[model samples]
Target chain A: MSTNKIDPTKWVDKYSDYLFNYTIVRVNDREIANDLISETFLAGLKSMKNFKGEASERTWLISILKRKIIDHYRRINSKKGQAEVRIKYSDDSNEGDWLEEQAPDRLDMTAEDIMENEELGLAIIRCMENLPEKQAKIFKMKTIEGFDTEAICNEFNITPSNLWVIIHRARTTLAQCLEKNWF
Target chain B: MSKFKSIFVDCSKAGNCCDKAQYNEASLPEKVKMLVHLALCKPCRKYSNKNTKLTKLIKDCDLKTCTEEEKQAWKEKIKQEIALKDRG
Candidate 1:
């Protein structure tokens, strides 16, 4: 009888970044990605009654987002064979030479590598959620956003020394959380 | 004794410096003091190594966040929809 509850109110704060990163890498267009996420949220709300609460809210939302992404591709694909043009290897001239061009580019990531990095990103976000709210915010602003120490201090109304202490604590906690699986 | 005290830092200061160094924010003198402490302290060295690895992993993940304006728009949509459902 126990099930995870869903809270629409907290969705933006809790999972928006995770979902955004997941989406942008796939869609590769900021505007399209934003639209897809909006649609996903709307769809999730409309289907709220069907949710059994068996899965976590995030997992459920992600399932809906995946559907939206697929639908987007399907829509574009159905429009005048636009998808066909994206297949560069389909051209007849490169018949024998295509395989050579398929060799992995040194600068690009393999699909598996990209997948692992995505998983790692999600893991870090989950660990960050475990931190106190202020600490998590400060850590993200400093480490992820690359804000200057003085700038952050002025925003948070804290001194440089206080900011460093917070950063030190946040880093230590994050390291411990990731030690077993990632470190 | 006073000169030695000025040159050497304790573990806590070393940890702070290590964290700052992860962000490339530590001054050269601060880094030198941290290294001196790390040389003599086993646990601190371990902490430093783990901290460095943590920084690298985070950088490699390349996580991105939604802008506040976009997040606000989503939140507004969700709120309006919720209000409509409640009324209906």
Candidate 2:
């Protein structure tokens, strides 16, 4: 709301926790996440004039933060100069180290059942990360974006039939991952 | 599973998990499909819905804002910047 354009100070006061939690949720390393947060705010200040307020300020800022995190990983991968980075955006996923195992009975659960099942919820997030690239894209498009068929096909460059295949594959993979890992 | 001669999809496109229509048109054919694999298997239906609900809850919720210490630090930083701006 300041006349001077991007208010780094305002963004810091407003969304720092959101940004912190968002980065920490994706990047496990505290120092790396903090560095990314700082850089996101720094970059956001530089680009604030260009933001144009099309999306919510939060979305704009988070988009910058996410891009920065992706860049961080890219830098590390390039440093190694490997074929590709092993980082599948799955690095922060919690493994089985946290909780005592019970069973895969969540397969028989409803929304209420699983939310109450916090362990199961964490496991499901991990399972989502393990999905194949195409399948993960489909699931994210459908489940997260709430996109209908035509839009998704256009975004992913596949026919509706192919879209169906991808979603099916993703659902199957998710089910299996949940059963084996967290269920 | 029995493969059909391709329903409306002629040239044998790769089979999908389930078509979008199956999600809605609960016609006999839709019932013949798996979204309702639940009425036949309520447990699995329960599981699928559970996942959907969890995702919705997370996506549609409030995200917490900056903390007290963070706010204080931000104010102090802003004050320092303003002082420098005045001096300039």
Candidate 3:
């Protein structure tokens, strides 16, 4: 286990882009992503003595950045109540179901088609940004990272019901947003 | 109770069913209720189908990354901060 300190000077030029790209995708906020990068470097510097060269510098930095992202979400989740207000349906008769008039037209595109449509991709990101911060983070963890329900509940210190409610709210908002913007 | 009573659900319940199905968290009764609702309500069915597709789209979409200029600026900022800390 080599104990040489990672030179702080070379970090910016070598790994900044990789780390920035990684964080921007997960957080979808450039300012926040940049902040995480700064935090990662500072944390890394403090723990440089513990670096054993087991993972490449990039991997180590990414691991730190990942923790920072999780911490960011955890901090946000702790402050907010678990039971978010339910979204109101257009019509009271149907309880909380979407009104027929507001129901989105069926999307006909395939996964391949969506992948190629840069406009649609941007639209999706915009919709995600519109979601409440905690919902957006939870949605990303579940869908993008494919974290299981138990893992997510454990991480957020939320119950299964709370997790499901958040997921439902997030999906409904995303579907409605995409339908309005993309379809 | 009749099987009809057990299986029947309103549109709102159907919406919950759709969301639960996305996560594979719906119970057997909820699943049955959703299926019945979808069969009868075209709009709810469309909602369920689209909701599922949206999850798939996000899972599949290749997200955009930071630009080179942005990356460079971030790196510069980090370097400046670390240098200041060292000076202090």
Best by DockQ: 1
TM-score of each: 0.89, 0.35, 0.49
List of chain A TM-scores, every candidate: 0.82, 0.42, 0.46
lDDT of all the models against the reference?
0.90, 0.57, 0.75
Which ranges of candidate 1 are over 4 A from the true structure? A80-105
The 10 consecutive residues of candidate 1 chain B with the worst lDDT sum are B59-68
Query: Model 3 off-target regions past 4 Å?
Result: A1-119, B27-29, B62-88
True lDDT of residue A108, candidate 1: 75
Backbone clashes per model, in order?
0, 3, 0
Name the candidate, 2 or 3, with the larger DockQ value.
3
Question: Model 2 off-target regions past 4 Å?
Answer: A1-121, A180-183, B1-28, B32-88
Residues B1-88 of candidate 1 have per-residue lDDT tens digits of 9987887999999999999999998999999999999999999999999999999899988988777799999999999999999999
Which lDDT tens digits does candidate 3 get at residues B1-88?
Answer: 7976878888877887788787777888889888988999999988888888886766555554445576577667767777777798
RMSD of each: 4.4, 18.0, 20.5
A1-183 per-residue lDDT for model 2 (tens digits): 333334556666456655765766567666677678777766765565698756767778889988999999889878785565342332356454333333255567577753455444444544565677567657766765467888888988889778776776676566666555443
Q: Assign candidate 3 its CAPRI class.
A: incorrect
Model 1 chain A worst lDDT window (10 residues): A80-89
Considering the two chains of model 2, state its CAPRI-style docking category: incorrect
